[model samples]
Target: MSSKYSLPLVLSFTIHIVLAGILLLGDFSSPPKPTPTSVQMEPIQAVIVEKSKVEAQINKIKKQKADDAKKLKDLEQSIAAAKAKRLNEAKRVKELERQRKKKAREKKAADIASKKAKAKANAADKIRKQKEREKKQADEAAAADAKAKRIKEENDAKKAAKKAEDLRKKKAAELKRKEQEARERAAQQKLLEQQMAEDMANRQQARRQQMMTEIGRFTALITQTIKRNLITDRSTMEGKSCKLTISLAPSGFVTNVVTGQGNRIVCEAAKTAVYKAGTLPVSKDPEIFREMRTISLTVAPDKFN
Candidate 1:
């Protein structure tokens, strides 16, 4: 049969052969000898003698065989049971080992996948950060360039403004100079006309002396008049002389009077007296009139005081 049952079968056969050999040896060694009889045997006694020994031996062998067979049967049963148990245990251990190996493989695969995913994520993050840094740098550079451009533009505007202002100032100065020159030329022309007219009349020297004398006489007359018309204390008017310049029109009427240095009331009275004189009794020469119309007079009330 199978290798597993071979040993039990061989052991049962060996036990049976040993028991049979013992029985055969016992029959050969104890063969039945002639039975000594005291008297003639009965027929029933002969029969009993002839079969009794062999029958008793056969009965004994039968009982031993029955006991051996029961022991062999019990032994075979126990061995079969042990083999069944060992086989079941081996199968269970193999199944457990297979499950363990499968679990280990799954765990290893999961670990590898996780590591790859983590590496990929790290790489992506690194690239993103690098791009961001580059973008930031570019922005900074652009801003710097923009700032420089703006500063340059501002400086250019300021320079243009300054240049325009300088031009305006130069133009204003040129106009002012031209106006001053024109005014000087007009004054010179008027002086030349007066000189020419005096020369034509042939009374230039005499007219000048007469005009000087008349101006002096008028000044003395104004001083006396102011002294006489004093409404204030005479001592107050005694200290200073009132000098004035009066402008007259060609018709000899006073056009304007400017006080040089004098008390306010005395200057006012002197100006009024000069106005009352209307036209001075003098030559009508244009040369003389031109000088006399713009005369300087001093009214010193103190001189008459």
Candidate 2:
């Protein structure tokens, strides 16, 4: 029998035994007080007791005790089976709880794993996007650099062309300026030469005029002196003239005299008078003196006193 039912079964069996003992011992308990005997004179009769009937009654009591014992044994067996069934049910319930806990733990672990996988996938996607962004930026930067380089090159080319053109223009202007300067120099040189020639001609002309004036004045003095010394006979020399050439030194000393194309008497008189004067008026200036050194004169004896 299961221990759970053993105590109750034993207690029930013990209570039945105690009830049986009470019943058996109830006759031996102190006898109740004796009732008063009745005094009646009645004739007594002899009765035969049957031994088979009494034996039959004793056997019936023994059979009833055995039936009760059988019922108690059956009750103990039923209680033990019920207790065993309860223990089995409890074990079944405990096993079901264990399985439920295990399933819960596995489900929780699965959820955690799924979440971790999703997180890893998200992280990878994020990294990929970051890389794409960086690559796109790099491409944009490269394109910008190329464009800038092209623009710079174009600007440099334009600047170079402009510089060359400017240089050409500057050189052309410089050459033109030099040519103009040369022309101006030539014109100035020609002008200077012309001015110098004009100045020289003017100075020469003035010097000649002054020399002629001096020569004329000195020539008149010589003629007057020759006339004063003339020993002419006016009656024979009237309306007759002679031309005489006289030579003089720088100091007015007479050097020589010759007569030309005139009456011989008049010419002789004039030449003799010129010699008699001993000296003639001459110029002190070298140029005027050169002209006066040999001078020609015309003399006529008319109304001489």
- Cα lDDT for residue 155, model 2? 100
Q: Candidates' TM-scores?
A: 0.27, 0.45
The TM-score leader among the candidates is: 2
Q: Write the per-residue lDDT of candidate 1 for residues 166-232, one digit (tens) a residue.
A: 9999999999999999999999998999889878666756766777776667545544544455444
Error of 1 at 169 (Å): 76
lDDT of 2 by residue, 228-291 (tens): 9998886789899999998888888888999999889999998999889998878778888887
lDDT of each: 0.74, 0.83
Worst lDDT 10-window in candidate 1: 222-231
Which parts of model 2 are misplaced by more than 4 Å?
A: 1-165, 303-305
Model 2 sits at a Cα RMSD from the real structure of 55.1
What TM-score does structure 2 among the candidates reach? 0.45
